[model samples]
Target: MCTAPGSRAFLEVGGRHYRRCEHCHCTFVRPDQRPSAEAELAEYRRHHNDAQDPGYRRHLAQLATPLLQRLPPAQSGLDYGCGPGPALAGMLREAGHAVALYDPFFQPDAGALAQRYDFITCTEVAEHFHHPADEFLRLNRLLRPGGWLGLMTRFQTDDARFAQWHYRRDPTHVVFYREATLRWLAEHHGWACEIPAPNVALMYKPVL
Candidate 1:
């Protein structure tokens, strides 16, 4: 029995299978078969998303567009999983939000976790999580009440084409989540969720 990082759902991949957890329903990749943190980091570095292209920015904006309008000026934010260049953090700062940058590989600063924030962004980072439950719970712990957690990732769809999907072609991607999964997460975590885009979601923890 393997508990997925976020949910307790049973998972079977590459001939490896795991029992589901009743509490979280997270489907996890087995330890022996799962990718290691070191192997995962090496593959993340191979992403060439730093190129400042209008098209690329627009592609990224697909994730940030709705957020640009929703986030208030000067609200604190964390650009979680900002790859080597920290582009999303720069964009949030340019938009006048006080943004802090952190990445397990690029900007792993001990102090980044010291304070809470009003918002957080994780673009193209969820799929690489080795233990999403622990990782996502950390994000939850870091977020202040009413803070927003934005994520950019392709939602899993049940289709024969997924195997051939370019997004999954990268060896780095391991975990898969669907739109319902995001919804499930928000409900379970007490956050209001919005999926304005197919690849983006905004979850807000209510100030109770």
Candidate 2:
């Protein structure tokens, strides 16, 4: 959805036009310009997604560190969009939590989606959502009461800066979210939201 209410084209990246939702300040590439499934999968495969990669582990720790602290012993979680390596699942498993993995491309375990979780993580994945509102609502439904949803996408700061942002270069990165957009999500879904670190957010489902 275009951000400006009137829904005007905002920017053209590599000849692909994008739209911003002014009300929510969310930006997204037009549907017709989106990459094919094969291309997107190929792009993902290019990433160094090895779980044993020390640098990758450190980057995931940005979310895992805080999440591990909040989870009690033996809680179960799901690493939604865990990608090829699923290092975050490995990390949480090491912390004494039972973790299930789901990735549409690499680990498309349908049974994982059938299960609910005490907490769920979607690091560096939310931006790839083609239908963010629906996907987010689905994620919320997957949680148990008082469950956590940790995310690690870079937030869009402003329009002027968006044109030059490095994160937008990825063709699969469709939707962009702002801090205010996230806060609106919290208010809309009745989840308590917190941003403990840069490009990271923790949303808590109500205990009820």
Candidate 3:
């Protein structure tokens, strides 16, 4: 099995090998089994992404649309993993919420984490996290009470299609979350979660 330091090895369902962290229970595709960082970066660069891409504009609106409905008129947010261009951030700003952009590869602002937000978004990004359990908790901690977390990623739909699901073909996609898995996560982390669409979810912090 492919095991990284501090990450435990788990079962391989189909051709994918898994590593389960004892502390996190995140069944991840082990590092040695994954594509090289350079290869992954090259693949990411292949995305026809630009701030001016109109299709990209409407795509970002999917997250902004739900987030706008949930948040107050002028709430602040952070678009975590905003990719090479902060389209989601721009969309949120247009919706009237101030948004800060942070991407590990692009913006890389450490200071952004210091500021809490009314909501946080991780569009098409969570499955790429190296430490999802920790990161998911961090996303939780970053939100103020009654705040929301909007995530856009394809849900693990069916075991029958596990081999053929187009989303799984992405080399950078390491973790796959089922609806029940997200539910368990929501309950585990003390948030109210819902998969409003097949590809999106909204998690609201518990109001005390």
**Which candidate number would show the highest lDDT if scored against the true structure?**
2
| TM-score attained by model 2 | 0.94
Model 3's alpha-carbon lDDT is 0.78
Clashing residue pairs for model 2: 2-20, 2-21, 3-20, 3-21, 3-22, 4-22
**Each prediction's Cα lDDT score?**
0.75, 0.87, 0.78
lDDT tens readout by residue for model 2, 1-208? 2223465588986787998777877888887888889999999989848899899999999999998888888999999998988899999998899999998898889999898999999999999988788888889889999899999999888788777788998889998888988887887789999998988889999987
lDDT at 126, model 2: 91
Candidate 3 weakest lDDT stretch, 10 residues = 1-10
Is candidate 2 or 3 superior in lDDT?
A: 2
Cα displacement (Å) at residue 54, model 3: 2.8
lDDT of 3 by residue, 28-109 (tens): 6875677676876787889748877898888877777877877888998999988897788887887788998888777789
Instruction: Give TM-scores for every candidate, taking all chains together and pairing residue i with residue i.
Output: 0.85, 0.94, 0.85
List the candidate 3 regions with Cα displacement exceeding 4 Å. 1-15, 18-27
C-alpha lDDT (0 to 100) for residue 43 of candidate 3: 79
RMSD each, Å: 3.3, 1.8, 4.0
